[model samples]
Target: MNPVATWRRLLAEFAGTALLVTAVVGSGVMATTLSPDDVGLQLLENSVATAFALGALILTFGPVSGAHFNPVVSAADWFLGRRAGTGLTAGDLGGYALAQTLGAIAGSILANLMFDLAAVDFSGRDRSAGHLWLGEVVATAGLILLIFALARSGRSAVAPAAVGAYIGAAYWFTSSTSFANPAVTIGRAFTDTFAGIAPASVPGFVVAQLVGLAAGAALTLALYPGVGQAADEVVVAHDGGTAPTHAGRP
Candidate 1:
């Protein structure tokens, strides 16, 4: 791809992730404000907002960057597509990850500023527990499985709504409230709000997520042996109906 096109994709990842995190952190703040005495209500409000925003962001940016707001997704795309030579190159993967991470951080700051809180208040909410790690693994694994399954089955059309609905449900089913995305997890750490995960908890969550990514990939391959053929279209095909042909750009 040309430099301009590459930059557009990178910027799409950045902006999409930023807006997603903004919705998450901002809604959490608003939820607490609106439902001061009810944790369940606050979570419901937060999750609903996040789910809607996530789906919208994906629909808006999917054509530009495949709407990969998570490092694991990008990595999985590269891994699955490596053999078939249909997905992102190593350089693009790196760029996407960096942009997403930075965007998450910036999003946290934006949410804090909007809520009149400290810009960089590291979360104190300790979420480091064996069960929480299990939840992360489950959440991330399910997410990967769902995305790849949709791609492999040629059902990418409903990805936006399906992904959003899955995440919203995961929030209630998973013990960790489903911080399925590494970038989102890191972003939540920057805020001391209802959605914030303590900085110390991040490493464990990320590790579990990576493990989940592996498990999910194995499952996808087992279920759809030719899933790799759809790697360039994972989440969604964003190359103007053409898959990226940079198979040699390792």
Candidate 2:
């Protein structure tokens, strides 16, 4: 991949992830402040709204950047051969990871400002140990399975919708409320909003997500055999040696 294209893709990931977390946490804050007695309903509403927002954002940006709003997803894409290995080099991973982390923080700050919920405390509020770990595994596995299915089926065009819907559903099905992205989880730590997770607990959540992703990838490899190679088609360069156009499959 061209260096310039790599930079553009990284920038797109930064912008897209910022918008995703902003919409998710921002809506959570809104739901909490506006709802009367049903906090569960509020969380459901916020999660669904975030899912739709994420779908639209991915639809708009996936062609340019692969719409990897999460580090686990990026790492999985690398493992599946869908990313330009050269573009996701150590330096590139550092840049993307930093951008994602900062973007989540910015999103949280924005959500707090918008909802005037800055006074809420965020420490020691996250679910941990026992049931939470199992929930994380289920949610993360669901997310990766959705991604693998869509990408493998050559339906990359609709991957955003599929992924978004899976997340929305996972919110209801999982006990820990589906924290599928590490960057998003960490960013939520700074806020006392509806989606907030305690900072001290983020490492455990992240580790669980990674484990879930690994399990999901292994399952996909076993079930589909050649699916990883098929999904890899999405990011390959084109005939002219330049990065392929949005309309072209790799």
Candidate 3:
């Protein structure tokens, strides 16, 4: 890829992740404020907003950056690609991760500013719990499975909706409200709100996410044996009207 193209891709990843965290944190704060008396309603509002935002972001940025808004997702993509000799380059992986982490922190600050709070407040909310960790595993596993499977089957078009819906549902079903993304988890730490997690709780959530990533990858390979290699293909029209799948970036 051209150097300019690589930088553009990295920039897209950074901007995409920042906007995602903005939605997650901003919605959580607004929902909590609006539904002070009802935790359930707050979560519902937050999840709905997040789901819709996620779908829009992916659809908008997928072609440019694969729309990886999470640290685990970025790492997984690089791993899968390298394994198949067709994914992101090593330099791109590191750049993506760095950009995502920085964007997440910036997003948290932005959300706080929007809500008339300190720009960077360390959360005191105690979210460390065994059940929560388990939830992270389940949430992340489902997410990875969905994305990779979509890519494998050439149904990447539906990923925006599918991923968004899965995440929204996971918020209700999972014990931790599905903080499946490490970048999101870290970003939420800067706010002491309904969506915030204490700095101490972050490590456990990250660990669980990593475990889930591994489990999801294993499951993907087992379910779709050639997914790693075929996931980067695109269907192209030839001289005739027929469209054939060929190896390309997802």
Model 1, range 30-142, lDDT digits (tens) per residue?
99999999999999999999999999998898888888899999999998888987778899899999999999999999999999999999999999999999999999999
Q: Candidate 2: deviation at residue 162, Å?
A: 0.6
Query: How high is the CA lDDT of each candidate model?
Result: 0.88, 0.71, 0.79
Which candidate number would show the highest TM-score if scored against the true structure?
1
> How do all models score by TM-score?
0.94, 0.85, 0.91
Best by lDDT: 1
State, as a TM-score between 0 and 1, how close model 3 is to the true structure.
0.91
Which residue pairs collide in model 3, if any? 81-87
Model 2, 117-154: lDDT tens digits are 66334645766776887898888877877776556656
Q: Estimate, for each residue in 1-250, the C-alpha lDDT of model 3 and write its tens digit.
A: 2123777767877888888888998999999789899989999999999999999988777767677888777677767767677556678778988888888888889989999999999999988999999999999998888888777666677777888999999999999999899888898998887888999999999999999999987887788777666434211111112222432423
List the lowest-lDDT window of 10 residues for candidate 3: 234-243
For model 1, the superposed segments whose C-alpha errors exceed 4 Å read 1-4, 239-250
Q: Which candidate would rank higher by TM-score, 2 or 3?
A: 3
All-Cα superposition RMSD per candidate: 4.1, 4.2, 4.1
- Alpha-carbon deviation at 241 in model 3, angstroms: 18
